[model samples]
Target: MSTRVLVQQLQSLPDGPVTVSGWVETVRDQKKVQFVILRDETGAVQLVNPATRPPAEPVDPSTGSRTAEPQDAAADPAERAKRDEALALTDTISTLTTGTFLTVTGQLKHDERVKLGGVEIKVASLDVAAAALPETPIAADSAMDKRMDWRFLDLRQRRNNLIFRVQTTLEHAMRTWWIERDYIEIHSPKLMSSASESNAELFALEYFGEQTAYLAQSPQFFKQMAQSAGFGKIFEIGDVYRADPSFTSRHATEFTSVDAEISWIDSHEDVARMQEELLSFAIGAVAAKHGAEIEELFGVAVSAPTVPFPRIPLAEARDIVAARGYDIPRTDGDLDPEGERQISAHVKETYGHEFVFITDYPHEIRAFYHMRDDETGLTKSYDLLYNGVEITTGAQREHRVDILMEQAKQKGLDPEHLQFYFDFFRYGVPPHGGFGMGLARVLMLMLGESSIREVTYLFRGPTRLAP
Candidate 1:
């Protein structure tokens, strides 16, 4: 009846009686000894038991007597009782299956020779809680889709577990940094009367059996409303929906968006400065806490990004990509995927940085709410790229009601339909800007993973919608 201890705790405790509970990972039943590798959430440990085999005898059918020597009667009562207990324990261990949840009472011994955690446990008794089927559906080399089909089982791998741990540490660090700086956290409603960003990517559903409500593509409108409501700064980590049918490595139907908006910014540069600093703080915290484990598991060294990430205008970035012998194939005036990768390579080679801000996008490719420079006719916006992928979009918003209406009109959006959003500007809001970033994208890049699906807890893509 010893207190149950985690496998991780065995290393710090002195050799003594202890109880450990976890699912069975592996078992090695040898002729003279038995070994069980039990893994709990914290870690795995080795459990040892001396083998006790049953006596081989031919019973006399009528007399209930054995031809072999009757060791049970000849031995002392205490010795017989101990032998019986050992035989039972050995049988129980033999019947144990992989992934069976069990509790074991044992003597914890620290042995230098023990490969796992330099500790071993001499199991005295085991109590099986739940037994698993012998066959497991997934393996280490299973295809990604097959593994995702059994995500619960897939997550049992230690490397997968560390991804979430790193995510938790990253999120907590970001939240702490924001709260310390007096940023208000908000949860904007997901069901909106209209699209939050663009009409093309909205999930409209029937609401109250009367009107239609659209799933928000972003918290853009409400975050802007907060600026008008006099909230100087706000941050939100919440789910956003997109109706995009993209089958790319980074696209998802639903995702967690990490958003931040601050009032009284001079231009998009202010927002970029804040975001870079925020990322630096969060990454530094993660590196300090889990750097060694990340390198061990993911083989990627986690480092805090330097301040003042190199900035290149969108036009200049395209030129840099072209100069590298690649022409952007798209005519949208925005950097295509290849263009982003090329520009990222150039920045890495020239500045030795993994991040760059591509600023001053042409107004054609930006949202209507983004402020445009009167002289340049380009939006005061920037796309933040990390590890050659665009992870965020931030911009100075058009706070003037007149300009907002004209911009909306130019984009073929009815000003009356968006009057509710325009009302925020009518009340005299301060000049503000912010960014929305994909949480999974950031984690994937941090871990050097190829797809965001590797980092997402439950990725919702076009074709995936189940356990």
Candidate 2:
């Protein structure tokens, strides 16, 4: 009876009898020797078993004639037991499937000929925990939708496993950074009596007695409420819903929004600086922990972006794109997908940086609560783009109740309908500002993944809702 160990730990242990447990990755059933590639959470290893065939006829030395040797039931008990166990293991290893969960008692032997980690396990016994089906529904080359259909099986790939590991480290680092700065962590309600932002993207449902409640599009309103409650700085990493019927690779019906609000920011510049610092910190933490592995697995080097990410006003960015022979197709003066890519290319070429802040968006394209500069009538808002994809939107909020009401009216939003959000301003709130960032979008761009579905644990879109 030996203690179970992970496949990764076997390399460091001295050669002796040991037990390892994991899902079977590959089984090579050869005539003379058998090998199995077993994989666990940490890594994979090779397991070897020499063939133990049944008793056969003995050859005579004189004339090379066969001497009859019938299988005997009454053979020596001890030797028979050993032979039976060996045969059973050989047979069991031959029958094991690719995803079978098993615990193997073996002798860990360091062999130079072994390719996987330069170690091999001579299996003595195997206890099958579960057996997977013979036919696999997906493969490494499976389509994203089909692979997501069987995500539990798909995640068995080492790279997929690493994605989530990196996600965990990134989030923990961000949380630690916030917590150390005395920022309050809050969980705003997902169900709201009114819309959090635009009503067009709201997921409305009947609550009780014909009362309709909507899923929060973002924590924008309540996070601002925290600022008014005297929580100077606050952060929330939680789910936010959007009902947009978009088929783009970057769009999702529900997503994890990493939000932060701070009181007393002079303008959106302060908020942008905080976000840039947060990204650099989180990226550096990931690179320190998993840099080598990420490079090996993802083929992308992880680097902590330098501070003072290149900034260009929205008007200048549009001009830069126009100079490059691309017209923004959108009528609202917002950057289209191609425009973002072109401007990002320009930033990378001119500044040698992967991140850029496109600032000073016109009030026409911004939300009602964003503060507009009096002189230019442009909102103090910015969209953070990384590697040619926009991942965040931040702005200084208009805290004056009078101005807020007027802005809501100008945007054709009824003041009475938004009275709850307006109430926060009336109670004398701070000059607060914050941003909402898409976590998957950041990971996708960082990892050089082509689609947000690649980084999201469970993608929610217009068509995808099940596991």
lDDT of 2: 0.93
Q: 51-154 in candidate 2: lDDT tens per residue?
A: 88776777899989987777665489998988888889898998999999999888899988888899988888889999989889999999999999998998
The residue-by-residue lDDT of candidate 1 on 58-82, one tens digit each, is: 7889999877665554278898889
User: How does candidate 1 score on lDDT?
Assistant: 0.93
Worst 10 residues of 2 by lDDT: 66-75
Show where candidate 2 strays beyond 4 Å: 56-69, 72-74
The true-versus-predicted C-alpha distance at residue 148 of model 2, in Å, is 1.2
Worst 10 residues of 1 by lDDT: 66-75
> What residue pairs clash in candidate 2, if any at all?
none
The per-residue C-alpha lDDT of model 1 at residue 385 equals 95
C-alpha positional error of residue 153 in candidate 1 after TM-score superposition, expressed in Å: 0.3
lDDT of 1 at 57: 72
